[model samples]
Target: MASIKTFINDDFLLENKYAQELYHTYAKDQPIIDYHNHLPPNEISDDRVFGNMTKVWINGDHYKWRAMRTLGIKEKFITGDGSDKEKFMHWAKTVPYTMRNPLYHWTHLELARYFDIYDLLNENSAEKIYAETADKLGSQAYSCQNLLRKANVEVVCTTEDPTDSLEHHQAIAKKDLDFKVSTAFRPDKAIFISHDGYNDYIDALAKASGQEINTYGELCEALENRIAYFDKNGCKLCDHGLDKMYFESYTESEILAIFAKKRSGKELTGEETSKFQSAILLFLSETYHNYGWVQQFHLGALRNNNARMHRLLGPDTGWDSIGDFPQAEKLSAFLNTLDSKDKLVKTIIYNLNPADNEVMASMIGNFNDGSIKGKVQFGSGWWFLDQKDGMTKQMNALSNMGLISCFIGMLTDSRSFLSFPRHEYFRRVLCNLFGAEIQNGQLPNDMEWVGKIIQDISYHNAKEYFNF
Candidate 1:
């Protein structure tokens, strides 16, 4: 908000001279380590190109889709069968409404960074802007691999299910691309034993692991085999998405009986479901520890709120919101269990609800034990809380309650290729925080040390954290 002449010039988010210097010098040119994202490895392997802007930019982009729907746009122009240009036009028309939202800045930043078009997109500029981007995207040079290279990304870990073949990841590894593309084991389908088609998913898991799951121990063995396979294929991280951390008490015998009943087509009661989930999650976390892999827990998301729309569209289509769950107690117990067994691997806890910022920042300290630098990380602002206010709150909390210096920084946690600018957005916000403190004399005037810290957070820490 401090007077800036250009919309997205060199000093876009950097307000003061100190902020400007920190961003331009320390953070700007650092290669990105997108430790977590949803980019399709197949596209990276095949170097897929798009025919138009809508295909790569808007399609499957729930962020833009939600904004378009909010502007009273019809479904036909959104996820419906409307033409690509029609969808792009609807999004262009919706851009101005997103003025104060992060989308406004992101839209212009992407346009500037990717296409070098500085014109504000709206009804008048939509046609020209769309055409210009369409031509660039249609070219072979703008394929998925080239797009990632353009972003200066060093490594990106895409999330995958247990039943995944990892074929695309295998092919990408064979290419020996300049940037490293890796996968994270996401075994949500195996953990959520109470959800619909749980047994069917287990059947698929059995097929993938080449094992028949008739008992609880066998299921764990199947998951263990897949973990070994993923580990062999260069996977370095694992991720989980849960409404809250589960830590219910139950014996192995009870859990076995519960799974047996479920496999026999009987539904588990609430207690049984909790116990089963807690058991499998503990098993997975311990296994991750054995493999020397970093683990991530994305908690507090309340997904699929609209049933009618869910029936039409399905999950992860912008229907998720923050869940106000009782976090600390169960999360602490779960981690403590692993830590007590000396089985807690490097962990990153991402809270969707900003209210838990301080809770998570302080919670990581309980089990850090000095075994690793920032061993238990309070992760970056995620999902619903990825904006400026949210990111600032998270960083400030981490700085206050924990050491922000050792932190592994921002990740897109996104599905789009252009979303890499979000890392830029986070770096600017981080520099602004450190730079502002320097301006006010809260921190030393030493630019060298401050710049070092900024560079570490920007790239070095993640590089070392994952050892990539």
Candidate 2:
């Protein structure tokens, strides 16, 4: 227990004096700009409080779910009918085994930061910690909005589908909250013509937009309507999750014919699918540019791999992994098309595959064009790569290829409200990197200038880049 305390102490990840000073001085107090995440806006609007630890922490955390499954925990105790306490116990038991995993750090960081419970979460500490968190969670002081306040979050932009009402955002706006809650338009379903339920989703989109979609033009108009609605509701950004970019050449008439065939319940060929996706994606990007909105692309996730498990548990239930898609040529073509038309908006690209880190790093440089500061950003390490080693590699890649000082850094991209400490984790890692360089005399001992850059990467850059 004493060793565990020392392990997670104030200078947890900071190994040297310069590293500790950089973190505690310049980076520790920056307000979080979580520009992309999957938190439910309704929860923030309603200010709902969880009943217990598992309800808030365990339920819907696919990261933890994946680790537990890998350790052979039964489905009954994980995402099944087992009681909340039972599931939590299983998680607590799994903590010691998660030693080298990022979960180990995140778990303790969340517990310490949110609950002030520094004890290592395991079989021995689970009961006491569970009871303590449950007691605090039941209070109004620990409600969803208050949780964001505890993290000193300045702004959080939740992702919503085009079919969303944004009523919750309206509800949140009505109150005088300390922090701001904005939303992003996610049009993945509208673009995925080859996926099952594509037409069904179009029906939902039509209903939401109050437009009838009978043709490709109508589909675009309906999407445009939703975009207008989202923009009116204070959405300054949009997000897309795709395996890779689609740059297939197709005429407007060809896309129209493909849409007509898909609407007729005929399965389109792979070529047709790619063409339709490319057309819609281009349309969406152009529209976003017109609205002056930032666009984020989360690419290379090979989602829902285990069909057997996916069928049983549904998507995003620990079934996705990094994909090795060839991202260079098509991505360049897509961005070049937008750039040529002078319609490329502020863009951030996140690649899940570590192999493409340098590729993504250099790719952003091609379109920067001196239009804006870091106009096309190689985004932070995401999903499986949002850890110490991964973040270091990503920073190193960007530093090698481009300007790291101009880099806008770190977002939770998480569903859990308690996950805000990830920003702090990123700060620690970032400071350590800069501090290590200074100590090695590779960088001059200029704390103020360097600290300003640290703060910029930690908070200021995103604040200015998103302009939210």
Best by lDDT: 2
* C-alpha local distance difference test of each model: 0.92, 0.94
**Candidate 1 weakest lDDT stretch, 10 residues:** 1-10
Model 2: CA > 4 A from native: 1-3
lDDT tens readout by residue for model 1, 351-374: 989889999999999988997888
lDDT for model 1, please: 0.92
Q: What local lDDT score does residue 41 receive in model 1, on the 0 to 100 scale?
A: 83
Indicate the residue-level lDDT of 112 in model 2. 87
Candidate 2 global TM-score = 0.99
Candidate 2 lDDT tens digits, 185-301: 999999999999999999999999898998999999999999999999999999999999999999999999999999999999999999999999999999998899999999999
Alpha-carbon error at 189 in model 2, in Å? 0.4
For every candidate structure, what is the RMSD over all alpha carbons to the true structure, in angstroms? 1.9, 0.8
Model 2, C-alpha of 93: deviation from truth (Å): 0.5
